[model samples]
Target: MVRCSHVHLYKNGKCNSWQIGKEDKKRMASNQGSSHLNGHSDIFLATSRDDQILFNGILFYLGQKYIEGAQHLPWWRTDGVILTVLLHAGPVEFLYYWLHRALHHHFLYTRYHSHHHSSIVTEPITSVIHPFGEHIAYFTLFAIPLLSTVLTRTASIVSFAGYITYIDFMNNMGHCNFEHIPKWIFSAFPPLKYIIYTPSYHSLHHTQFRTNYSLFMPFYDYVYGTMDKSSDSLYESSLVRKEESPDVVHLTHLTTPESIYHLRLGFAYLASEPHKSKWYLWLMWPVTLWSTMVTRIYGRTFTIERNIFKNLKLQTWAIPKYSIQYYMQWQRESINSVIEDAILDAEEKGVKEEGLNRNGEFFVRKHPQLKVKLVDGSSLAVAVVLNSIPKGTTQVVLRGNLSKVAYSLALALCKGGIQVFTMREDEYKKLKEKLSDEAGNNLILSKHNVPKTWLVGDGLSEDDQQKASKGTIFVPFSQFPPKKTRKDCLYNNTPAMLAPKHLENVDSCENWLPRRVMSAWRIAGVLHAMEGWNVHEVGNMMFDIEKIWKASLDHGFRPVTSFAESKAN
Candidate 1:
């Protein structure tokens, strides 16, 4: 009688037979006993169930899509395999390469691809445990080859189903915590050996993503020069030292503030602090205000032009000379073209400027509306808002000069019924005083008490400061007195008091805030600003008013207006 480790009794009072080798049976009994002893059977079952559910869901969705596509191409067509391979292979290879590169792109890698890399030491389950977007992207990309094929409908469907099953098994086995499958099995069918991917092969692929991209066959990877043989050597070497402990790998250190900012931004959407009561919703108002102030103060100064050439050079790790020359040439052409157009417009408008300098710097000596114009005729706008001027307290200083062009913009936002908050009584008084004169008595100023927290301004009792610092935005302004100069505000005493080390390297005011903060700020601010205004009017007004403008030629539109003088009668 053949004994099986797993036994099931039939309703007919008979037992189904399965082969259980003597050694295998003993090992199985030992593992079961150990699991029972440690009370780990439930944990194992739960893990297994989770894995099964996830795998089944992914597989079912992918399979359904494949089947739908396959229905159009039946299996009766002769030479279908040849046609399918020919048509599908090239496009699949291209898309695979493109997506593979895109996965490594700075933004995508940080958010989506990084999740996959979390499992430094991968198992088959790890392959499927990725961001849903990434998983979908990979699945879709893989299916493209089948979709592009000219195989008969039935053949295509059958082949795709078989392929998925094969892939699933291979992926699982690759991460299988076992070694040494029968070598004779692979040797029996030499071609099928390459056709069917193995755990060993797929394991190497995960270990080093640059190679082993081929799902079933190595032919495409070889042709594309992406098939790395070095991973094979690494795998073989690992196997040779089977007795050695599994090598531990740690995640790469996120050493910069920018990295941390990105991480926080990605997580912020999903994270929520527990709250109760309608009034707690108002707490988010202050958070929104703080986010807006920090984002605006930081995002502008750090705007770098997106140069494809520079990016390519960085990717290749090229020398500075070539990169700089490439950048300069591109910059020169771009500037010159803008200047030519600007010069023509100025000449037509009867405006004069100083002769273009060697560096093409031009200056207008006098212009009523134009504060300062570049040789390229670009203008600068500055806004200065000084608030909270009181004795013994640091002045709430906002110093940036707004150009005549931006006056209308500022007015529109203020006029759109935004409740501007000021800490200083005098500052609020000044604004209120001007409102009737400038805004036709539409703007009203009420004495709403400013948050005491805002007045604290880096000055509070140690415990209070610590509490304020816990979740508050810390903007390190050069103009603000340093820790040594500030008598009241504690600084550099502990990690909480000090500016994050990453912020030290970030010199530009514009680049200080992360992108997500900027996005949230704009969204929150616009909503708040449009509170009393007609939604339609506010929406129309906001049509072209960009909240965040990158430093580029296209930064803000030049509004055209026709100025006419009344005829002398």
Candidate 2:
């Protein structure tokens, strides 16, 4: 229910709700209260939806069997439309207002209404998650208008269908947790306030528990003096467009073509997990192909998702280019333009710091004088790779395309008394030059020695895996994950930490990272803002690994093995 693909629920990052896959029961128990007791289960939501369909069917059957004018086929009737609206605005709203207030009384509230109130931050589906007894009472109350219209011979199919559609629209809109009802309408027509209630108004009913009891219309709440005192101000505050400012921006890009669907604006379910090639997604290849083409021509960076980490606002921005495009030699200038534009745009928006993926290093070299602090997060990533090496391991193979993190990881490992071996003489020389004389003593260049732990990076090949011993663990030091070459060997996820449970609106996974897990590159920008550090960690310079590691732990970020643990589970 939390991450259902509802249009009203997700637009503009307005809804403040989280859960997508399996419930983090231990983490959820601290906050969700009794709502954690099976109400949020997929089965409960499915059954609740089915029950409403069944209830509507029974109502139709009764009407066709007993009502005089229920089976009529006229499509439109002006008189019927007028009568239905009048009936709802008068009797339907009045009676339901009382019924709703009555349901809040202690006896009924405990048995039925509390279930609906459990979701303090609501979704569109939250409007229907109620006990069966409550559904029955609601169906009967709603049937008043239909029954009255049918008996009076003023009912038509349009009037009946239109009234039902209105109810569904109003119910979903009010619970969507986003204020879609523009305040300008109320300003233009002052009397419309009595007839319409905004999402903020209904939200108060759930939060305050006793006031603002009207359903879709606020007339009764005003008449009875039960409306919340802050409804108008709250509505105004939610609508005011504040400046576009964020504490940190994680600048990344799309990966495989299938990654198009993994964006938050894309499919909800796919976005909530690691990227995987799905057979069903192949059927959607045309759309994927079209999207890729569009991005190539568009050449801009756009926000894919947003989150609130503690009190800070976080955003993930994606350059229109894909990972494959970044590899193409001809696309370098175009790619640079897209990335530069994104950083400048972030700077213009008052972004304090911007985190870059590995490919973004080009911008640091090209535009060294830029104001916003740019971080590559190599320090934390190096720390993660070093700590991931199994305990009591004396030696490990370091392979693949040598990056700043890879070099730093090798040096740190050699410095710690663990022997670092490299098969490539060129990579060995590159790393040896950067190490201290004592640390360099542990670095060995050889092709014959086999180590069970291989610290790999980008461009790891199938041949590399074949040379390694069977069941070897491939731990990645690169921003992107290495392709799995041997099913017999274990692969770990890249450097990331399990995000705190309190981070709000984290409904999607970060690339291949698990639910609620954040990549170190992304987290580095956040740490920069939290620490109020003003330095740009670009090119060869990086923050102290120990300091970043300690800061991450202090902020409740627990280290996770790249992919080994997730694959095992």
Candidate 3:
């Protein structure tokens, strides 16, 4: 009996992640052209891809169950394989070529084929989006090879499996919208072009809608005069295309060892949702250990995400070191080396702006001669925190490790006639020295008083959270979010905003931020490029808070309100 191994398919086969070609590279540089469908679509549109896979599975199951002499077929037979190939390259190819052309005819085109052609820019999944009736017709056409082998009692399980796998691979490759098939293959064997089709070949079929109608082979198209004239030129150009530099690059680091899987290159579903550690991941502890060891040994910067806004290309790169490494004194130099290399690389790429989180500030400060505008996004983050504060509040307790954002927020609050209280004498004196006489008067030292509003940052202690009254709001100005200790108290998300409607491919949430939301620090870099600000907003330097706030709104990044604050209001 033929033994079939249960196979679980990854997205577009195993090579999808590694085979990003020129066009695929371009698509990878932006989130706009991903294969994931939005949930807002109708039920049919949403589930159509899954349904197509199911349909194929049903066809295979029925063929095995009902066909005579199919169940106990041998695993391999040379004659069966040769016959299958000849039958497919002749009968199946010929039939499919004409059938595809007929689908484009006016009557069939509008009724069924148009659904498949709806996407001009195709992804791998786009190959399977035909209507149910079209699927039945196409499957029947493909069944020619399988049925012939079965009826003749010459069928082998390997022959059937190989044919189906070939079909699936070819279908996906043709619609991938990227040129991955190496030109060398065709050059070595000129006859292969007639037998094997490329992505550019099928792309012409979609764009022109009248030519290149051969299925997997161009022999019939050449004979019947339906071949596209520009096919070879397009393929050659796509092969020689060079990589383009992005306008902006945001540098970040892996938060946890498991956080590696949360990157877009890792798992699509996990990357899209808010990041959280799964309990089952421990089962792969050996793999995780190897990854962590490899990353530590070969620490280099790598691309994490790619995005586009307006006409500008933006990319997010992560330092190989995990978050814990950043805190180790021994790891500081290694971390600095990775960050400096990234900054220098960005500068070389003609990137106008590079954003670094708080961890990267040391490098920017140490290297004053850098030409690229390095921004920490402190101005916009401060703006987000200021706007999150509830109105009609006179006093706010400032607690946590004082970072640049926290310092700026305290000054802004004090200047706006709101009293700022600090529990630590050293923090109060440090803040007092920087504040103007008018703002300084508003800064107070107190320990026992409780205010409903608190502007918190990193290093916030559990004791501090425990002291807060019920319904107290904790608004963070730090790059990292503080741990939640009080359920009754409302803890706002780290400063972030809803992304503009035009932001495409926002299928994944940013860390803990909801879908279509971006952190203020990240957005600040985009704003700098959009406004063409020449000055670097690094170290203690900050832009006008009001200006930044207005610009964020003008660019369509809406302020995110905490649920607790919203409920209280």
- TM for every model, in the order presented, reads 0.28, 0.70, 0.78
lDDT of 1 by residue, 196-299 (tens): 44556655554454567665556566667777776445434444532211011000112112222222232233112111123333546655455445633431
lDDT of 1 at 94: 58
Kindly list the per-residue Cα lDDT of model 2 for residues 187-227, writing each as its tens digit: 89999999999888898877776789998899999999999
lDDT of 3: 0.77
lDDT of 3 by residue, 379-410 (tens): 88899988888878899999988878888988
Local distance difference test scores for all models: 0.34, 0.77, 0.77
Give all candidate RMSDs, comma-separated: 27.4, 8.3, 9.2
Q: What local lDDT score does residue 207 receive in model 3, on the 0 to 100 scale?
A: 68
The candidate scoring highest on TM-score is 3
Higher-scoring candidate on TM-score, 2 or 3: 3
Evaluation by TM-score, superior candidate among 1 and 3: 3
What shift in Å separates residue 210 of candidate 1 from its native position after superposition?
A: 4.5
